[model samples]
Target: MRTAYRVETVRAAESALMARLPEGTLMNRAAAGLAAACAELLRPGLGRRTVARVVLLVGGGDNGGDALFAGARLARRGIGVNALLLAPDRAHPAGLAALRAAGGRGLAVADIAPGALTTLLGRASMVVDGITGIGGRGGLRPVAAELAERVTASGAPVIAVDLPSGVDADTGEVRGPVLPATLTVTFGTLKPGLLVDPARQHAGDVRLVDIGLRPLLPVEPDVAALTPAEVAALLPRPTGESDKYRRGVLGVAAGSARYPGAAVLTVGGALRGGVGAVRYAGPAHAAVIARHPETLVSPGTPAEAGRVQAWVAGPGLGDHPEAERVVNEVLAADVPLLLDADALRGLDPARVRARSAPTLLTPHAGEAAALLGVARERVESSRLTSVRELAERFGATVLLKGSTTLVADPAGPVLVNETGTPWLATAGSGDVLSGLAGGLLAAGLAARDAGAVAAHLHGLAGHAAPMPATASGVTDALPTAWQSLTG
Candidate 1:
């Protein structure tokens, strides 16, 4: 699992490690890693014929120190290194001295003309953003924001130190202007912002730099993403002794005459979700049967549907008058249940909380916002907070679907899914995801694992699908995604 810690946790671990080492040891380790990454980025362009130029955007605190030290290292390598000091008074004193000794130049941003700064940035091979560290919050200050704008205008590929300045290290919230990076070199361990969205989009590609702080860090991460190996371990595989019934049966209650395609897509996803049998119960049985004859289709409600290991409710059962009754019947069933799409409408928290069986909820940001009585914009901006709140409020596992899908249980670390492409945003995709997760639930994965694993596979399918992937295309690609993981 790729894990992330909060800023405070990372800081504590850093302090613990620093106490055991020499004064400058930790900074040197960070600087060395930063310089190495920068050098590697510059290598392809610098074919012995071209001279490499590096510009560091240095701010206050240890962040500035890291850039200055890294600049010194580049200067020693015969690379032209210049530092733009955002805070001349607060720049790391020793680090600045070292840069000067190594023939690196430092110019305060205040003293530089706008046109001259633009020219310098345009000529630079790479820009190192060390403007703010984890401690800095609420976005960049005015002077720094202007500089960031200029740097972006230059179109230089940037390598951020730790994280892009202006993004919240703990919350992943970008309140004001942010300097997006081509790559981010984070020290010690990953931060929540690096893994979560809004802030994640700004962080192009993330590289973790281990500075001997792992051993000192806490065992539990604030957030985590499942690696392929870990996901494979969690996936259910049938043994020789396993029969159709022994493997598991998933009951799906979805679709209406108005939107029967939802049922077809949902059933398609369930069939590839490692389940033995898919028992589909709803109004769209004929449509589902036509598409997937293997499905045990029934026109009756979910309760009348034969014994099932788990149930998936909602997904386009739009105002059929009996839709609520079907949802209630599925909710009342003593089996693991996943709620999605139309089934999530007017959902009662009390009903979900009272359920004896495990409950999982998959809601897009708008649905999530409605459930939490918050604005959709709020949920989108603060994804982590919104998902966690929904999980806690409903007392159920929540899979909030977006650019970075998050699966969170009532408690414990939230799981972030990074496998998906933006193309997964096509319509009826959530229905496919709902059926996929429901099948996992039937296959005996815990609510959290089922939701997370389903998201992982769903994302992979999105990638495996043809470009401009449709919901049906994603469903068709599930087997390929499954094999890619299990293989």
Candidate 2:
């Protein structure tokens, strides 16, 4: 797992590291790493004698100091480096002196004309953005904002010092215009903003500049990006003594007369997800059996769907009162359950918390907003917090799906799914995810692991599917995804 530390935690770690190291040692290390990365980007064409023209958008904090020192290194390598200081007076004194000594020129943001700035930005091969850091609030000041706007319009490759300007390092929220960087050289630790969406979109490629803060860190991590090795470790492996029943049974309560296809798709996802058996109990039994002959169709309610290790409730159930009734029964079953689609509406936050079994709630932004009694925009702006709040309120594992799918348990670390393609945004995708997660739960995985594993597999399946197709395409690609995982 790739862990992301909070901004405050990163700050504390940095402070601790600085205290142990000699003065200017941390900044020098950061600058050295930054310069090396930039040089790598310019290799073959632009050799050791750096003839490339570089532009730096310097801000006030140590972030600007990082850029200025890097600029000095570039200048020493024969690169023509220019620093556009946004806060000239507040800029790091040591960084400024280093840049001047190394033949790097500095100018105030107001000193450059609009056309001149645009022309220079367009001509430059790389632009280093140090306009803000994790300590910044809101958007950039007018002058810095204008510079960013121009730089963006120029279409030049940008290297963000710590994170993209205008992006909240802690929350991944982008309030105003931000300079989209081709690469982001972050120091000490990975911030949550670089891993989450909106802000992630701006951080093109992330590179960590190690300043020896690992020993000073407290705790492990709150959020993490699952790697292949981590996902493999979490996946359930069959044993020689295990029978079909021993592997696990997944009870699927989905589909209705109005949306029978949802049942088939959900069952497909469950079967593909390696569940031992899929017991289908819903109004669309015929449709499900027709599509998947392997699924055991039952005519009874969810409670009477026989003994199931886990239950997947409410995919395409519509607004039927019976769907709500099924959800309530599943909640009372004392078996792990994955609640999705129409089932989400049936849940009363207070009642959901009363359940004895572990519950995993999968909700899109709109559904999450309803659960939280807040606007969808609010949920989107702070997805991490919103998902955590949902988990806490309902006493369940919550998987808030979107560009960045976040899975949070009531009292555990949050897992952010970052491998999904935009094509997975199609209809019925969530149904597939619900079924897959339920299948994992039936296989005896923890609620959080089940949800996160399913999300990871679903994302890989989406990526494996043909582009410009429906979510059904992603469902069809599940076999390949599974093969890639197990193979």
Candidate 3:
């Protein structure tokens, strides 16, 4: 699993590590890694000495010092190096001296003409962004923002030191214009902004440079993502001694005459969720049977449905007369339950909180907004806090599904799903994910594990599907996704 720490936690760890190391050790380590990565980005032909130019956007803090030192390293290799200092008077003295001694030149941004700066940026082979560090809050200053825009216009591949500027390191929130990186070389450990969305979207690909801080960091991380191997180990596999009952049965209550396809899709995903049997109770019996003849279908409410280890309620009930009854019955069931789509409407927090079994609520940003009585925009902008608030309010595991799916329990580190494409945002996709995660719950995984694993597999299946993938396409790719992990 990959873990991410908040800015404060990382700072604490860095402080402890620096106390024991030599004065320049940490900065040297960061600079070395940054220079190596920048050199690798130069194309083969341009890599010849004196042919490639690397421009560093130098600020006033340690962040700029790191870039200056890295410029010196590249200068020693005979590559043309130039530093554009945002705060010429406050630049790191030692680092600036080192760069000059190694034949690299530093120019103050204030002194350069706009046209000249644009031309300089345009001619550069690569740009290193060191304008801000992890402690930076809000957006860049006006001059810095203008420079970043010019950098973007230049079309040079940018390598961000630590993380892209103008993004919240702790919440993954972007307040203003940001310099998007082609690659981000972070030091010591991963930051939350490098993993979560909005900020993550700007952070391109992230590479961590370990500087011996892991041992000094805290045991608990603020956020995490499951690796393929970890997901494989959590997946259910049948033993020789196992029977259909032993493998587990999932009960699904979904669909209406108006939207029978929802039932078919949900059952289709459940069948591939490592569960031995699926007992479906809904009005779409024929439609489900036509698609999956093996499903145990009943045209009745969830209460009348026979025994099940877990239940998935609400996909396309669409305010039918019995929809409320079905939700109430499922909530009363002794087995674990997954609530989604139409079933999530007018949900009672106390009823869910009182359940003896686990309850998982999967909501898109819009539904999550309704649940929390907030605007959809608020939930989207602050997903980390919103998910946690929902989890604490309902006392259940909440999965906020989007480009980056997040699973948050009432406590413990929140898990983020890193695997997925924009193509997964299709109609009826949530129904499929509801059934898949419900089946995992029936297979004996905890609410958090079920949601995280289901999201991971759901994302892989999205990738396995062809471009312009549909909801049914994602469902059909489930088996292939399973095999890629288990095979």
Best by lDDT: 1
lDDT of all the models against the reference?
A: 0.93, 0.86, 0.91
Candidate 1: tens digits of C-alpha lDDT, residues 1-487? 8999999999989888889999999999999999999999889654222678899999988988999999999999988999999889999999999999999999999999988999999888999999999998898899999999999998889999999999998878899999999999999999999999899999989999989998988888999999999989999899999998898999999999999999999999889878999999988999999999999989999988999999999999998789989998998999999999888898999999999999999999999999999999999999999999999999999999998899999889999998988999999999999999999999999999999999999999999999889999999999999899888
Ranking by lDDT: 1, 3, 2
Residue 115 in candidate 3, Cα distance off native in Å: 1.4
- Candidate 1: segments with Cα more than 4 A from true spot: 44-49
lDDT of 3: 0.91
lDDT of 2 at 178: 78
Better of 1 and 3 by lDDT: 1
Candidate no. 2 TM-score: 0.97
Q: Better model by TM-score, 1 or 2?
A: 1
Clash totals for all candidate models:
0, 0, 0
Model 2 poorest 10 in a row by lDDT: 42-51
Clashing pairs in 2: none
Better candidate number, 2 or 3, judged by lDDT: 3
Between candidates 1 and 2, the one scoring higher on lDDT is 1
